[model samples]
Target: MASFVMKQMVGGKLNEMKGGLDSLTGGNEGEGEKTETGEDPEVVAARLEQEERRKDKHRKMEQEREKMRQGIRDKYNIQKKDESGGMGGFDMADGRIGAARKKTPEELAAEMHAEDDSLVGQLGLTEHVEKAKTAVNGAFEMVKGFLPFGK
Candidate 1:
């Protein structure tokens, strides 16, 4: 008996929620509140304006992101594939965005070699300096051992 009462209460609440949603959405499944045959001119204009604003926002964001990516590429000495004689090298200039191309194995290898050589030169010099310091320290210890001194 309690379960039956609970079910009826739940069903009534669900119906009320559905009615609220329908009212918010202009009540009809296939048509809005204006009419069955045509849309309001003002509503249409508003929707178009909204869409234009959305596109503008998206374009601005993409331009900002591209600028940051360009800066990073410049700092790392990464070559832009779009630098060839063609205007559409990496990104096309025709206002159409395209996916980035995957780099070739050879290109990857070359970049890796360049980066590795720089790292090796830096680290190798540091390691040699540390070894020289250790040798000096050891020589100082030997000299102190021979000195006639007391603590």
Candidate 2:
């Protein structure tokens, strides 16, 4: 009878060990942590600030893109022709905005690559525009000097 009791206790101990090993090896990521959703206030505040900073940066980027697009439109003399344009947003144009045809994926991708700098809101464009204008104007002046008979 004593031997039988000892055998039962040994078997129970072995079962508990097996169960513990199984849990340690293969289980959900946060299986037994206390209060998984609970976070410190400081951590939450920091996270929020980080998110706001990210959003602000994104907004600034979006604004820069708008400025570049506007610059291009002004360069090409596009204007707002219609008061209403239903669903597709703005009835505006950089110049008589053409038909609303969408570009294929490949075409769009190519266009995007060309406009990469504009999207990133780079500062080099202002210098580029100024230099180009000066060069062209200087060339015109030189040509005018050569054409003394006309002026």
140 Cα displacement, candidate 2 (Å)? 75
Flag regions of model 2 displaced more than 4 Å: 1-36, 80-86, 89-151
Over 7-102, each residue of candidate 2 has an lDDT whose tens digit, in order, gives 999999999998888789884544454344676556678889999999999999999998997898899999745446533642334334644545
Q: Evaluate all candidate structures by whole-model CA lDDT and list the values in order.
A: 0.77, 0.74
Candidate 1 lDDT tens digits, 13-53: 99999999998987675455464448866688799999999
CA lDDT of 70 in candidate 2?
Answer: 85
The whole-model C-alpha lDDT of candidate 1 against the native structure comes to 0.77
For each of the candidates, give the backbone clash count. 1, 2
Residue pairs clashing, model 1: 82-90
